[model samples]
Target: MSKPALAVLLTRHPRKPPNILQTLLEVQASLGFVPADALPEIARSLDVTEADVAGVLSYYPDLRTARTGRHLIRVCLGESCMANHGAKVLDRLRAHLKIEVGETTRDGRVTLERTYCVGTCPVGPSLVVDGDVIGRVRPDQIPALLEEYQ
Candidate 1:
């Protein structure tokens, strides 16, 4: 985002308390993803170190320093999901999307990621597309599931 926008957002909410996390969230909400250029300004606005802002950015999986694709596909690779052929599903997704975990597709349509769990162990191979958790995912279902996002 532009520096002017950051200044406007920072000074916009004087009535509310100044907090590091809240400020970052607001920035992310407004800008889609927190821009790398935003760290210094965010730190200055919150009176925290730039490292503080960067740390929060790295610590939170939801807070991304870079912009993501139009759709995010995160497949669960936890123990149960692995047992249920989650790895196979992930491989199929990788091959279909032509991108590895933590990378966005060339067309910027989708981003593929790997998560330890989605809290549905019994379902095993679970898939989360844009925050919607889907259970019992299979390798064959990968194309249809991804097609929805496309």
Candidate 2:
């Protein structure tokens, strides 16, 4: 699916200095995730091996190999957030969604993820739902919040 876009990206940057990381980021940004099928083509374009491309993809937490749900739910696990019952919030979300962290729901509505420090320390236990920063989140609020997305 991403092969054509990758090819165009390669052609567009043919004269520029090789920046594998940036190129990969562009690919992910364009296609949501780094499609495995596009890796070989990307590697060939960059004059590198498939393993090298795969390594870059695996090394970055932000880079996803599989397609995520329509919405991404990131619960902060930083010091302030954890101290403020962030773990409980995560647990509640997982239980309510019936999916573990890093997994998407069967309906493909939401993907749960854990991140560190969203910089909303004053309102600890923050959650970012599809780029909306939600702070002071309570376990009981999860269902209601998720309902909005649904």
Candidate 3:
């Protein structure tokens, strides 16, 4: 089962502090999200407690514990993005998709999520569509942006 495979992720971590981050990232990459059921397995593999695994999972915004859609849309709402009217962009998406930030479209084509920042604050109002960082996002552009994915 994949749970056993998850242990393989930590096999290379011999003497260092249990690098749970990389292991969890790999798990997420394979399963799309870290299944709650695998938490104990991950901890046992790394010689840490289940709480440690859960802590790392909850601490990282990029990590997700729930299944998302085929296309993951992460909108930035950091101070810089919000100052640049990022909320309007978020509102437009919510209206267009008729789904809130942690929701997937009924058809499961798209999943909308909120991110603090994508490190493009200089441009502000940035977002990520399927891992591609986009800056200077205007509300009017949301339709065309989503069209490409939908």
How many clashes in each structure?
Answer: 0, 0, 0
Q: Which candidate, 1 or 2, has the higher TM-score?
A: 2
TM-score: model 3 vs. ground truth: 0.86
- lDDT (Cα, tens digit) per residue for candidate 3, span 86-143: 9999999999999999999999999999988789999979989899999888999999
Candidate 1 Cα deviation (angstroms), residue 13: 5.2
On lDDT, the leading prediction is 2
By TM-score, who's the top model here? 2
Question: Which tens-of-lDDT digit does each residue in 1-150 have in candidate 1?
Answer: 678978999777654455777787888889888888878887887777999888888888878888889998898989988888789998998898888999998899998889998898997789998889998777898778777897
User: Model 3: runs farther than 4 Å from truth?
Assistant: none
Question: Worst lDDT window (10 residues) for model 3?
Answer: 1-10
Model 1 / residue 115 / CA error / Å: 1.0
**Candidate 3 or 2, higher TM-score:** 2
Residue 58 lDDT in candidate 2 = 92
When 1 and 2 are scored with lDDT, the better candidate is 2
TM-scores of the models, in the order given: 0.86, 0.93, 0.86
Native RMSD of candidate 2 (Å)? 1.4
- Judged by whole-model lDDT over C-alpha atoms, candidate 2 comes out at 0.89
